[model samples]
Target: MNFSQLQCFVALAETGSFTEAAYAVDLTQSAVSHALAALESELGVTLLERNRKGVVAISNAGQKIIPHVRALLASEAAIEQEARAARGLNVGKLRLGSIESIVSPALLAGVLTSFRTAYPDIEVVLFEGAMHEVGEWIEQSIIDIGFVVLPARGVESTLITTDEMNVLVPYGHRLYDRAAVTLDELYEEGFIMEKTQCMFRLMKRFGFELNKDKPSIRYQASDSATILAMVREGLGITLVPRTMLPKKLEGVVALPLDPPQPLKIGLAVKAQQTALRGTTLFVQTALSWAHEHALLQTVSS
Candidate 1:
C-alpha cells in the first residue's frame, strides 16, 4: 500500500475512531474510512474492529503493521529535512560530542570558527565526556555525533587521524633525560591508569598485562586532567594520546616511547541513522583539520 494509506491506518489505530483520526490528519471521516478499507483489502487483514462503542485493534497483524507505519513516517520526515539542507537553508541545533580531554579552548575555538564561518546560522552544541559515555550518547540519539579513539566496537566510524601515545612524566624525573624508553621500564613504577575497559585494550596493545593483583596502579581516573594532575605531582606516569594535551601544562613532559604506539581517532554516529547532515559535516571538518595539521593520513577504505 502507499504511504498515505499507511498514515491514515496508523492514525486510526492510535485514535481508535474514524472521526478522531480524520480530525488529526485533516481528512474527512469518509476519507479516513475509505483509506483504511483500501489498506485492509491490500493487506488481506482487518486492522480495526468497529462497533457502536468505537474502533479497536483487531488482530496481531495490526500490531505488526504499527511499527512499519511509524518507520515509514519517520523516513518521510527525514527526506524533507535533508532536502531543505541541500537547498542551503540549513537551520537547526547541531548536537556534537568529543572526548573531554581534547576539548581544549584553542582546539574547540578553531573548529567552531571554521564551522560557523560556513554555516553561521546553525546552532552548535557540544558535549564533552569520556569515550564510552560519548559512544553511548551517539547510540541513544542523545548526540548527533562524537569524536573518539578507535578499534572501538559497537559503533560505525570514519577515521580522522591516528595519534601516537606518549608517556607523561615530571620534567625533572630521571627518565626525562632519556630520548625514549620501553614499556617494561615503567612496569614497576606507580602507574596512573584509566579506570575503564579502555585501559585493558590500550595496555594489551603494548604487550602489558593489567592484572588487578599487581600493585603498579597508584591512581585511577576517568578523565585525562586527573591523570595529568597525578603525573604532575610525581605520583605516577600514564599513557595518553598527544592530541589531548594543551600547551603550558607545566611540570609534565610528554616523552615518545621507544616502540611507539598510536590510537586511532574517528567521527562516529549511530550506524543505523540514515539522516544526519550536521554529523556528516562535522566528520568532514574533523578530517580536514587533521589533514591540514599533518597529524593523520586519510583512512583507507
Candidate 2:
C-alpha cells in the first residue's frame, strides 16, 4: 500500500522472520508486523502465513506482488536521483542572452570554461544580440538570464564590471597625442557610430544629444568590428568600450574621454520569474569569475 509497508512486506518475505525483517528495515519487530498488517488490510488479502515456527510461507498474493513492489521502490529511487542531480546543478538547460560584445569567444572565456568544468551536464544556450535586444529577450522570458549594460529596464541584475568609453582615432590623427578629449572637442570630427541603442544612450549621457545637434555621421554600422574598421580607414573617429579593443593597435589609437562616461555591465534576469537552478549556478559562477578577475564593481540595481 505505502512505501514503508511494501518495504516491510518484501523484507519479511525474504527473511521469513519478523525479527530479521525488522533488523533489515531498521524497525522494531512490532512496527514491521503493524506495517504488514496495514498493507494486507488495505489490499484485502493475506500477504504472509504465520506459524509457531515464524512466517514459514508467503501468501500467493505476496508472491504475485513482489515484482511490482520492487519496481515501485526502483521508481522511487530514480525520482530521488533526479531530484538530487537537479539540486546539484548537474542537469538542466540554461538559456543565456548577451550583447554581441560580450559574446565574443575570447571575452568571458574563463568564466564559461570554469562553469562548464563544474557542471558538465548542464546545457548552456547562448543568444547574442545588441543590448536592447538582449534586454527585450530577458523581459519577455525568452531567456533565463542575460549580460547587458546596466540600467536594464524590467529586470533584476548583479553587477559584473564597469568600463569607460574610449575614443578611437586613426593612428595619425591630430588629437592622437591628447591624453583625453571631450564630446565637444570631437563634435565637429567625422563620427563613425555603432548603430545601437546603448551607444546612443552613452552619447546622450556625455552631453551629445544624438537627436538634436547630431555629430557628423560619416559612417554607421551595427557591428563593432565594422565601426572600428571604418575608423581604421580614417573615415571617422568612434567611441567604444576599452575592453572591446584588441591589444595590438596598428591603425587606430584609443584615448580616454576627458570627462569619462562609464559603462556599467551586469547579468540580468526577469524580475518576477523564479530563477532556475542552472541560472542560479551560472550567476554565481559569473560573479565568482568577475571577482577573481577584478572585474567586479558596485552598480545601482
Estimated TM-score for each candidate: 0.64, 0.66
lDDT of 2 by residue, 181-235 (tens): 9877876787877666456566775677764355767767887778888889988
Q: What is the C-alpha lDDT of each candidate?
A: 0.73, 0.76
- The worst-scoring run of ten residues by lDDT in candidate 1 lies at 292-301
Identify the leading candidate in terms of lDDT: 2
Off by more than 4 A, model 2: 1-89, 102-105, 295-301
Residue 228, model 2, lDDT:
81
**C-alpha displacement of 97 in model 2, angstroms?**
0.7
* Residue 188 C-alpha lDDT in model 1: 69
**Which pairs of residues collide in model 1?**
none
- The alpha-carbon deviation from the true structure for residue 193 of candidate 1, after best TM-score superposition, in angstroms, is 4.3
TM-score of 1: 0.64
